[model samples]
Target: MIRALALTLTLAPAGMAGAFELGFPVDCTLGETCFIQNYFDHDTGPGMQDFTCGPLTYDGHDGTDIRLPTTAWMEAGVAIHPVAPGRVKGLRDGMPDIAKDDPAAPALNGRDCGNGVVIDHGGGWETQYCHMKFGTVTVKAGDQVGRKTVLGKIGLSGNTVFPHLHLAVRKNGVEVDPFTPDAPTTCSAAPDPTTDLWEDPIPYDSFGFLDAGITDAAPDYAAVKAGLPPRLEFAPDTPALVIWAFFFGAKAGDVLTLRLKGPEETVVDQAVTIDRTQAQAMQFTGRKLRGSWPLGDYVGTLILTRDGVALEQRTLSATVK
Candidate 1:
């Protein structure tokens, strides 16, 4: 059986007005085709083999890829501005462009997420803008930026088949469907531009007024608990056993330590650094084990800490045959 555990942590006030907003990185022009690609959409079709459309892998495609055609012959170096005010968390430059056929390359010079910037919008939310032109990153990691601030210029770099920006939002370190559709899925050959389009910046509507009213609400513990789907149910008649555990609500800079204990507290002491400023959801599965120990109680604990302060912790128990 597989279960989902989510723990949310908010580092801002209970309610801060307009803490975060979504805006188009570039002005919508005739040739500029800006659309949001659903995480699921990226999974189906010919997009499967391309890892850029899949879930975040060890290779570092951390956020969703926002594709837009270039309106003009954009210079190799241009400036990308911040859609909203936030602190710059990560930046990389001096890389080269990636080949059109290879999606695995880094963002710069055959790299993925080429010369990019990640901005922390506070309140456990973050946004990543990838595929900037090389040497255009004007801000360094950890710099504070305001709305409309130029961070870099658009470019054809990284795992990009064309000139486009990959943008994504993470809440409490977990990526959600920012482009939630108002209607159900309609199977078709051509991509539906209406429902398929990325939702306009949540911060400003067409009129430039705050839409969602930037919020710094405390961690929604209840929502986090409710968001997690029920654990996978298993039967004793099952032939082979395979179990997975998915966890959400971890932020970058947090130290994640996992321990599996059966009779006593035996620690595995695996340490991982959450580099993505956005919330992260990870699934850990137990590979096939030929033999099974005596059916008993087992405990799995996930501890998250940052700067010596314990942020979140979760424990789960299971019985084996």
Candidate 2:
């Protein structure tokens, strides 16, 4: 029951931009990717707002949730990096990376942030990295960290259904939108100030314009909400593979397409027209390949378009044997 509204783009005067610049916190290449799972919320009980005043965030969310596609990726050691140069301000560790289903997990509380590190960059700026893998906090309090410094490995050590690093940036103790630190608060003026945050900010579209990937099987968000891992990667000799793509801030009149191209052929191609706008929607298509299965790379692509304009297009690949 979502509806699209005409997009209104805004940019603050160049004179009002911030002096600070940041970097992305994770290291990814090629087949590996990262995306914003949740964004800093700007609204109260009625609705939600992300740094971009987009629907990528949830109500009450106070930080950016940068995420990997699977916990297996987290377990294999995806290092979490600091976005700015700073000195470690606080450090906490030793929380086991336990799933919520494990009764042994610590009672959710202040512990919800789990093993993490907070770095204070002078001039009243600070950044906090939460949900780090247990025992992977490499920097102790007062340690100096440079941009992209490896502080820890990402993990599910706290109150989260997914494995990610919850990055909270603050200015003099007040939460700030890294994307629009120069303009007024997003709660006040959205379309987030055009003032970019990163030294070379990766625009929202570059990373998320299309948040998509291949799953070991079909994901039922119902099960995902019930504490189940929604994604699984394609395994060697598996019976089948599911391709799911998620489009964010999709408006009416947009056409969504999901395609699966195997080693030798186009296995599945599905498309649906958005009758109304949606904050996010998952479109999935899968196949049980015949014979012994392909022995090379399988690619999945998702493309979204509106009135012949390409809004977002991305592709992910999985090597299978």
Candidate 3:
């Protein structure tokens, strides 16, 4: 279960003097090619909370983390763009895109922001883009840039275990949540976006599918995170057929349904109610072969429901050859 904050609070004073609007910072399509992995931590004390008063953030986390579903996506390149026009104040490059936990990773030594760039948007406002890939920084320290400028590609660098762009917005020198620039003093309700800094409102998203696939047996979690290509076909004599899903933002009591069907018969159908809140989760269902699977196409579907509302569904296909 998610740990809840105990203190009661109220909204902070409205508005920042001369605050400006910002645009989406990535080149990929939202929800399809990239997802918001974390948001600015709004909790003033020890516990963490996002602008929506959710557990999508870590304690003292001061940025919104935009992530790709796989390292392969990162390797293929996902461009990082500025959220607004600004003058490049400073930049870093040439940091290899390696997970911090990898045996070959370099020491952090305070370079946790990894290969990053900082831009000054005037009026004491600035933005920082972090965890960028090596040799991808395109602008010099003093370049004037527009929102369309490609600063770099997101990467698994710095203090990060995954590939993402940790974007931090600031004013003067203090960190600010672009989603709630007014600095609401309470987590009582979702912030009113009328006062937010986004030129277009970015919806507050908490849950969805990250990856799904089919295989002949149980899949490894590490391999899923590494974005291994899924097995598209199985042999007739394979031991079992497995359907698995990788997702994020699971809440207690949420229901997950996994169903598999062959051209001639339904193989496995199961629904599971989650018992605890999880930032990320995985589930699978499979059945051992009864001699051999019928030679045909197979489809696997995953559905996530919260409060009886079907929130997401995804499907993968395979064939017996």
Give me the candidate number with maximum lDDT. Answer: 3
Assess every candidate by TM-score: 0.42, 0.69, 0.90
Task: Give one digit per residue, the lDDT tens place, for model 1 in 203-254.
Answer: 1100100000001122233232123332333233333332222233344676
lDDT of each: 0.46, 0.69, 0.83
For candidate 3, lDDT tens digit of each residue in 1-321? Answer: 111332222222346723688889988877878889888777778878788888888877878898888788888999998989989999988778888888999987778899999999998889999999888889999999999899999988898877899998877766777777776334536577787788886877678788889887888888888786978989999999989998877889999999999999998999999999887778998999998899999999999999999988998899998
Alpha-carbon runs more than 4 Å astray in model 1? 1-19, 28-64, 68-72, 76-78, 100-111, 181-321
- In what order do the candidates fall by TM-score, top score first? 3, 2, 1
lDDT of candidate 3 at residue 129, scale 0 to 100: 96
Question: What TM-score number comes out for model 2?
Answer: 0.69
